[model samples]
Target chain A: MTDALLRIEGVSKRFGGVIASDNISLEIRPGELHAVIGPNGAGKTTLIGQLMGEIGPDSGKVVFEGNDITVLPTWQRGQLGLARSFQITSLFLNFTALDNVALAVQARSGHSFHFWRDARRLPELRVPARDALARVGLAGREDVVVSNMSHGEHRQIEIAMALAMQPRMLLLDEPMAGMGPEESARLVETLRELKQELTILLIEHDMEAVFALADRISVLVYGRVIASGAPEHIRSNAEVRRAYLGDGKKKAAGGHG
Target chain B: MKTIFTVRNVLVFGLLAFLAVIPAYADVTGNTFIMTLFTRIVILAIAAVSLNLIMSYGGMVSFGHAAYLGIGGYAVGILAFEGINSGFVQWPVAMIACGLFALVTGALSLRTRGVYFIMITLAFAQMIYYVGVSLDRYGADDGLTIYKRSNFGSLINLSNKTTFYYVCLVTLFATMYLVWRLVNSRFGMVIQGARSNDRRMRAIGIPTFRYRLVCFVIAGMMCGLAGILLANQADFVSPATMHWTRSGDLIVMAVLGGMGSVIGPVVGAVALLVLEETLPHIIAVVGHFVTGLEMTAAREYWQLVLGPMLLLVVLYARGGIDGLLRGGRRD
Candidate 1:
């Protein structure tokens, strides 16, 4: 058995004639923050979709925690300790913020077939839901309904929901997609703290956050990983510079790490 | 048990109080017709409450909800035809038959969504409606009349109009309480969350399909009970009870009452049925004065007012009557 917590071996996917994931393969070792960075249309989201079982790879095996999850449904993957945060904030808009997180907590805690007790009145669920919200700096805002929350707050709730599931690994797709600068910084800090306790597959366009938090960075260009190594190696990789940084641009090398 | 002490809560309590005292007022006024009309309203309100469970809360708009009414009614009618008149035997059979139908239809229909879901459910309900029309021994499309109501023995008297009305009212409130408890429960939350965002629910490990199917079946069974009561109240069963227009009426009631709230559809039933009873008369009186037209002609044109009024409500009252009562606030 391999030591990798998640192994993507020779995965390829195509949307008709468009080669979205071209025989790409990567491994995420246990308890390490692995960031996949690419420009627009580098198949970043497609890769996440395949891993989460929303899109099937034409020819590849996705092994997670010693199970081949290539054909498993999205809910099964979630039950196997795999969680995803949508690039666009998706939450129960009509429910309270606490109710949203409580549902996620409810997923992992037990079967949701209990139809008698009020979930809102249950301390077992609401308490950890509150804890999850607090972890994402949404402490006092638990009672605020998501419909009234800001876009940035929705992003935070997305992460909080994943956290509430208590998954062994997280497949975060652009967690900072629409966050303001202040919100982005706060999320980066949250992710940094989160990485201390979990394995993370981060897909982001925020170069500064990538350089700051990623243990190892992989540069994807045109549905292929051209370089995968430490932050310093990727910062100086010749091909990555040409394809991503456009070579002669000043501050071309990302040195935040 | 935590009361919001809002205006909405006050109105809901006030409405309940009015319903509670209706029997006493009807007895004093010797208005048995009013009692009969309100009894029909309470029975329909139960069915609407069941629809609200999945329709509004679960985001499943089944356009053939009246199928359960027919199925339950047929179960009672068919059983009575076969010499089974016990409420115990008839009621459970009705529930199981409706539940089984819901299970099968829901399994297939849940595979589709949006307008397709609406169409598939409508198709299933119509299929049942025609089936009801073809039951030759049960009087087919002409309907069947019962010689006696289900024998409940000494515990309850179904023959007494006031007793039957009270029974319907009590059962209606019980259903409301059950639904209120349910929506606050874990199962209800799962259904509501799936309604809001099914994809996210799966991302967090909720197998939403099974829950949705169970919810569909539960709603069907509840409405099935309403159907049993409806057959007893009418002392008859017919294919007309399950017609497409009746299904549309239920939708209008749920939407008008306020789908998000449990009691909203009940209010909707009261409003729609009450309007149906009184509007034709009101139009006849007003039109005779204004247009100097014959009473029947004026009454026949009442829908012109109703059509515009429903359109206005749909456009302006996004949350329906319950929402309007709460000043457009959603629960």
Candidate 2:
């Protein structure tokens, strides 16, 4: 726990009598790819929302880099080296891929009160924007408007925008939410590479990617962590199988090469 | 991206050329009424440009925008009424009053979104309008006549028609230039991003409310400056200046011109005002020609034509005049 890069300690939330997060606790080690998997309404998105400061927990602490950031605003959390992408593809649809990434790049640089020079012309902002896009395999599509891009491409651009923030860690909420298998496979590869460089707390349902990429996996059901362990142990856990994996454990084990 | 020879660019340059030579054209044709009409359009165009900053670019549809214009014009009028007739003092007062109004309204109103925001702004504008009507010393609903224009003294004279017209025209151009610079800057990007997806903006670590508030205040100040110019242009100030309908007119101009482009609202202002000025004459001429009778009443129905033209623009020309010229390509 002392060495954990991010920790959620007994966080609980209720929405009009519905228990969304019930005494949830977890720790993500630095440089480890931690996956939180759950069925629909398992409060996976709620967990990510709490981490990103978009949702206020009814109780408990969210400690990032050993700082209690439970009440911090979302942007302040970003300033604290935490970043997140949306589950439903939230992006500046009117802006180009580069423009979207560049804005994320600008947000972390300094005060954006600059009202004179053409922002697109600034190399200082655009250079890092390009690098982030390139890192996410979106280099050639930088100038394309986000609305014109494919769903997969939008997913990639979302990751690029998060990367542009240059945060110490990323809270990715279903980066593979709507992707096709091909796009999902590409994203898995991208995530595989990114896990080596930056600490990632991923909430996803893509079983193959989760087993292949997650150094540690937590199973959540009805807003509570039922089990947490490494992929191999989680795969064999009798409780996890009964609760989540069901018949899919055999496929997840044999399905991936 | 706006390549020099695009149809939109040509039309913009043509409009600029026409505006620049209106005084000269009026001189050659011995038709000074055109100058008077265009000067009004030019000044109102400044107001429309300010609205566009938050409307088209920032995605903040302020239905109460006319309140600033009223505040600005009243600042000039009240100051002049008190014998403080200096242009320097009156203009700054107008801007400050408008800025303060925007700060308060924006702080409260920006907390809500969509129709609620629109309704709150409208409510504020109406409150100011009735306040204007209730000011018995300022002539209330009957309005007030400015006995003296803003005195610039040695710098320039506002009473000279040609000079005032040029002044309005120059100010319009400067406002356009400023908006052009602002919409392309880093600050502009945040405003646009917020408009596109505000949640995404906050999730990416931007305190969107502050940026939105600043834009609202800047827009208010700009409209306030236009109000000062408008008061000087008319030598009058009235409560009707801030009426909700006037705010609607600004919105119409923004949508009619193209909300996404900087010059779209200016184009809309020119088109709507010019049509308002000339349609009566056109209707009178056409009615007499076609009916072979004195059909003088048709001129009164000019807005009948305007309603449909706006409808057509809204339906088919979603980008407004600028977007139409750009063949409906939007950023």
Candidate 3:
């Protein structure tokens, strides 16, 4: 059997009597594009937060690379090869795109306590940042300030920042949430290219993109995983049809949904 | 044309050149007091720069910075009063006191943010001020006087006015350079990221609180060094040195200079101190011409005009003197 990159077993979370994740168990293998989908407030974001060590599961364990990391802090998990992007675009709007990515590269390198040389002037920090930006199709835009970028481009930079960390598996939350059809199509193509090289655990609402890109799909509702399978199996599963796609027209959308 | 004169770059190089040359000209003219005055400017600028590190970059506004200054000054003064005049003994005690205070205060204050954080820091500084007032041997509320400067021997004679001025200048430049490097370092990036969006930084696997707290302590320790030099410069230490209002003055300096860049606070310190020195003179001269008013009376009410001037700076010159001189170039 292939080594599982991420294994979540019986993980549950509660906030003041509200269940965010209810004993959700799932495994993501290396180099696979796994997608998580749910209706609004289905605990998708909370589950991603628990995976990145932003929130601890009330019960159950999160094992990554065969090591239990349920208690690790965020940065430690980051160092151990887990990287995530925000559902909301969060960036240093005051800084140039190059500066933002350069900072992430700096984090993975040695100690940043060196006080004399200007990091901007250092070629080591800039080279990898340049490479990361190029990978995200933002090569010439590195000098542009983040505030000046369009909403779609800002989203792209967010992913570029995560890519700069060079993680084993990428957790992307709502990567195409706010975009025009053209922008969404472009991001879909980019993810299609990236999936060949890196394992990705994506949470998105665009059913077309989710079905087009996800190697496997997991359906979440009211904080529990209701079904998990390949696109064909999930599409044919009867309960998934009733619980998630029971809205008659969406059910007609068939495997596309 | 705008590309050639970005507000951030123009102000940075321009200020460095001016600081380097001011003392050189003053020295040639034998107006040595200008050197002393500038030295005072440089030392406090160091503290202002430290405040900017946490405030502008880390997104933490602390009103208790002057407490570290007073703690550092008292460390030197109390040690001196007890016949321990060595720089070695005095400097480390000042740093340790500031660090200890910062660690405790940061632990409590970091739990709160925004206006609550501001008020809590102010309250802690006030507590320190009161403790300074109760030190009877160090002159209590009246203050402690240092009979001699720190003994660094042949390494640098701080007793000589020019030498001391150079020392302050070097330290100020060093601190500015250090802060510039810090804001661009990996740790600094995490701090800035936290400042920009703490929720996002945490989502992306960056633990933010520990970085912020460390930034807080580093800022406090830096201000402590400023306090040591301040006591040495004035040859005195007192409760008044650490008053919460004094912390207000440091904040004003950082804001007035422009908090976006490392060198802005230094420019603010020079502008403020120079104005403090020359405003009374201008007021006295104008008063003498207008109403034949006595110089002493004109001097006493100098603050009347000073308050309005600062208000104007805050109103019209939102970027402060650096911004004004650079023609409103904002980063």
Best by DockQ: 1
In model 1, what are the clashing residue pairs, if there are any?
none
Q: Could you tell me which 10 consecutive residues in candidate 1 chain B have the lowest summed lDDT? A: B293-302
Count of clashing residue pairs in every prediction? 0, 0, 0
Per-prediction DockQ, in order? 0.86, 0.83, 0.39
Worst 10 residues of 1 chain A by lDDT: A248-257
Model 3, B299: alpha-carbon shift in Å?
5.7
Measured on C-alpha atoms, candidate 2 has an lDDT of 0.90
Tens-place lDDT per residue, model 3, B29-79, is: 988787778778888999999999999898889998899889999999999
Instruction: Report chain A TM-scores, every model.
Output: 0.95, 0.95, 0.94
TM-scores of the models, in the order given: 0.96, 0.97, 0.89
How far is B4's C-alpha from truth in model 2 (Å)? 0.6
Off by over 4 Å in 3: A246-257, B1-36, B203-211, B280-304
lDDT of 1 at A35: 96
Error of 1 at A50 (Å): 0.8
lDDT of 2 by residue, B104-202 (tens): 999999999999999999999999999999999998998888989999889999898888988988988898899899989999999999999988888
Query: Of the pair 1 and 3, which is ahead by DockQ?
Result: 1
Instruction: Please give the ranking of all candidate structures by DockQ, highest first, separated by commas.
Output: 1, 2, 3
Error in Å for residue A101 of model 1: 0.7
